[model samples]
Each structure stands twice: as structure tokens, then as C-alpha cells.
Target: MNILITGGSGFLGARLARTLLAQGSLALAGAPAQPIQRVVLVDRVAPPADLAADARVQPLLGDLGEQLAAGALPLADVQAVFHLAAAVSGECEADFDLGMRSNLDATRQLLEGCRRAGHAPVFVFSSSVAVFGDSPEQRLPEVIEDTTLPTPQNSYGIQKFIGEQLVADYTRKGFVQGRNVRLMTVSVRPGRPNGAASSFLSGMLREPLAGERARCPVAPETAVALSSPGNTVRGIIRASTASSTEWGARTAVNLPALTTTVGEMAQALERVAGKEATALIDWEPDAQIAKIITSWPSRFQPKRAQALGLAADESFEAILRDYVRENPQAVKLAVKG
Candidate 1:
């Protein structure tokens, strides 16, 4: 039950590590069983203070590509690997070489490491909705479904799609039990923004709630798919434990999402933190951001995800409520614009 989590310092990765730590402690104490025994966090930088202090947690700081190329990755005795490391859409789209090296090349190296390890760990990949291209003319299907062939229009999406294939092919050869979870846009994320093209999804809510100005890079009417941080973590963990027999032909399953407009999201912020919080948002659409955001699928019929017991925020309002609950100090009811 030794587990390795790459990209363990980023937003989603950090949260996942914390959740695993809590779960791991409970399991070690003879409570209900948890899937992990030893947990390792691998990233370019050390994990956050809280995670770094966990006794069961070990932080491995290094460049994954460099380490993999040098045959220096310490992959022995690892029973599961959560490959969550990758450059985001905005960054990847802006820098082609960096995207290829970080997203695709590094993934290939990791799969090779697993193959060479001789013990096939359960490999769970953190893929994204970016893998899917624009929705077809008819309202883009309600759910993206499991069988859709990826037609990625952006460099980031293309890289992720390639990674999915790598996982599937490696698994087919019995090198590892691979599961790729295509995460929806995670919203109301705690902390500062990263370079993701979808950063605005969390930005519009986070900044305003802090009584600071937040820009809505896309139009208010732009309908986009979303998931909460909690649900996204759950999907990743489920991928680790799900039996290969139950996985079937869908190597990559789209996680459930709540489809809503930017305007609706702002309204939810207003409901939770008052008009002052809503006032912090100023609409200033950037064409590049708009283009990327609009091209992404706005709706998905995640029936496969639902059947797999993956869940999502019931509505944007619930997402906001959860954000406020999770970060009450950073967000207050004060009417400061």
C-alpha cells in the first residue's frame, strides 16, 4: 500500500495529499481500512508546511523528467502511483516545448519506470476535460460519456489525450493497472491562482470573497462545466481502489460536473458573501482566454461517472458555500469592494 503522488505541491495535489494523510492516519490506528500504508509526495518543490510535517508523508523534490531520464526515480516497492503532475492549459499552450516535455515525455518515462519496476502498481492519471474538443452543434452532449474519441484542439488537451493512451496501452500489456480520470473544471479552489486557462473559474469567486478585485476573463453568459475540490479528490481516490474488472472499456471516464454560467457563479458568490463580494468582480474579457474557455465542452453526460459513484456539486451555490466553509477566514461577509 505504498503510494506515490507526483505534482504533490500544486492545488489539487496538495489537497489530495492532505486527504490521504488524514485517511492514512485513521487506517493505521486500526479504524476503517484505508488504501494507503506509506505516502510519498513528489514535486519540483517541497509540499506545504502542513503536509511536510505529517509523519507518514515523505516529500521527494526533483525534476521528474530529469530524474526519469537519468534512471534515478525511486520507484521500488510502490503499490500505487497517482500521476497528477502536468503543466496547465494556459502555460502549456504558451510554451510548446515545455508542454511536451512536462506533460507527454515525463508521463512516458513514468510508465516506463513502472514497467521496469516489475511490480505493476495501480497507476491513476489525472487527466482533464481539455482532452475533449468543442461540443458538437447540438448543445454538446449532456455528458461527454466514456466512449468519445478525443479530438483535442489545444496543445494541453493533445498532451493529456496522449497520456491517456499511454496509460491504456501500458495497462493492456499488464505493466500496471491504469485508470485515467478526466477531471472537470474544479471551482472555488482555495489559495492563489495558477496559470490554468480555467483559473478564472476559481478566481471569480475567490478574489471577490476576499474583498479584492477579480476579473472575469470570459463573458457572464459563458456556460462551463465544473466540480468541487472535494469531489475531484474523491474521483482520484476511487480510481486507485476500483477493480479493473469493474473499469471495463472506459479507461478514461469524465467526472460529474455542474454546468453553469459565469453570471450564475457571481450570483452564487453574492448569495454567500453579499453584494460587496460580488462587487469585487469586474468583467474584462481577454480574447485568448475567451477563445480557450469557449472551445471547451460546456456540458457532459457523465453517466459512466455517475454509475461509478462519482459525485459533483449540486449547484454553483453549493460550491460557494463549501468554499466559504473551507476558508472562512480568507472570506468574510464584510461588504468591502
Candidate 2:
């Protein structure tokens, strides 16, 4: 079987690809576990060094929109598709056109191509917690439930919500075997900050630990739901490999997440790398970023995801320790105050 992974070069995408390759096989929606003959990484640029060199990986460069319009995206014989490509929240808010084109239009084009392919491929849409919007006056559930209707407050969130609906409808029509998972904010991201309003969530920990200064965009007390890259990739793989009958409903569910405050994260850093690493984080609050981030429900009653066997991390402290242990050369040794 062949798999197509949009945004396959990204942190989670790349990780998922490697995980799939390591496993050697994937379970197609209606089929038993089969060998993965190829993994087409559909992205705008070349895949990272490690992923590109693999014999099974095919790096197809350029945006999916242009690629599809030009009749370039390989849709036929693609047994599965993991839609992880998207314009991040900060970028979407900055450029509405880019967001609409990347987050909404690109997804539609992909689904349309899948419909045209004639094969009912397993489609996994990577949605976000941003789908749930909360505000000062209009408060959300303390722990967002699976039944809560999406109330997106920003362009990125709205786009993802629309994508979820698109995947569900497409699956309902039997055009594709679709499933969606509302991923939490992924933290301790490997690369530099991108345009996500929540980018600072990882930056505050990633940069400081790397001996570089980072700013905390939100207040110390403001909490955010997050998941580790390992856990996040596991969720994606599980969603992709699940049998159609096993999934039952096509709606997106919130993946389990660890909720922690900025202060707690910084404290975890201090515990791991010392007080000096804590000082590396500048306490500068950005209201615009905070508004968008805070609008996302931080606590989630992700019973559905847990029941599906998706796991959440224990705490922010554990996440930091894992990052440090995994990237020993990139991280600095703990310093005494």
C-alpha cells in the first residue's frame, strides 16, 4: 500500500513518516495490515535529510494547490492520506488570503482529488484544539467535551473546523474513508518558531533550554493544553490505521493533552536546567496573541480519545526531560544560579 502525507516534512509529519516506515506496514481503513510500498511526502519543499534518503520516501515539492491544479499530485493508488499541512494561526491572522488558500482551499483540492481517484483511501485530517473558542463573556466548559460544537474565534481555527466538516461529509458520501483528530498544541517543537499564535508555547521552553532567550507571550497563570511529539504522532498513526468500522463516527475528537501554565513550564525548566534557564525567558505579554490563544479551550474531557487508546503525557516536567534526553548535543548542561 502507498501513503500520502501532506506537510510530511514538518515536525509531526516527519516523525509520523519515520514511525510508519519503522513499523513497515499500516492498516488501510477497510483492509488488514499491509506493507507500505511507498510514502509520498507531499510538501512545498524538499524533505529533511533523514526522511528524504529513505528508499520508501518520495519527496514531491511545491504547494498541493499548485500541484493539484497542474495535475501533479499523485492521487491514484494512494491507499491513505494524512492531511497535516496548514497555515498556522499567527500566519492565518496576518494574511487571511494565505490562510484560506492553504488551510481551506488546499484541503478541498485534496479531497476533490481523492474523490476523483475512485479508490476509497483512508483520510486522516489533523485538526486543532483551536476549533473550540472561549471568551471572557462567553465562557466554555471547564473541560471541553466531545459533544461541544466547534466555536472557532480565529481564521486558523475556523479553517480547521471547516476542514473537519469537509472530511466528515466526504466520508459520509463514501468518496473517502475519513477520520479527524483535534490535536492539542504540540510542544518542545524541534525547529524555530513558526507563525502559530501558540508558537511561543514551545519557544518559551525550546529556546531557553538551547541557551537562547525566548519570550513568554501569555501571562504566567494562563494555562494551555499540550502534547509531546511522540504522543502526537501516535495519535495520527492510530487515527490513520483504525478500521472504518472501529471509528464509527467521522467527527473529530480532542486528543488527550496535558494542561499546564506558563509558570509551571518555566518551573519545570528551572528544575531540569537550573535557575539560569528560567531567567532566559523574558516575561513579556502580548495581548493579541494571548487573546487568540486564550480563546482556545485549555482543558478537555477527551474521554473519546482515551477510550480509543490515545495517551497524554504526564506533565510539562516530563516533556522537558524527554526533550533534553533526546537532544543532548543541542541542549546546554544545567547551570547553577
Q: What do the candidate models score in CA lDDT, each in turn? A: 0.83, 0.88
**TM accuracy, model 2:** 0.97
Off by over 4 Å in 2: 335-337
Could you report the Cα RMSD, in angstroms, for every candidate shown?
3.2, 1.6
Write the residue-wise lDDT of candidate 2 on 148-219 in tens digits. 888888999999999999999999999998989999999888778998999998898888888999998888
The window of 10 residues in a row where model 1 has the poorest summed lDDT is 25-34
Query: Candidate 2, which ten residues in sequence have the lowest lDDT sum?
Result: 328-337
Q: Taking the tens digit of each residue's C-alpha lDDT, what string does model 1 give over 149-172?
A: 677878999999999999999999
* Root mean square deviation (Cα) for candidate 2: 1.6
Q: What is the lDDT for 198 in model 1?
A: 94
Clashing pairs in 1: 142-300, 142-301, 143-300, 143-301, 144-300, 144-301
TM-score of each: 0.93, 0.97
**Local distance difference test, candidate 2:** 0.88
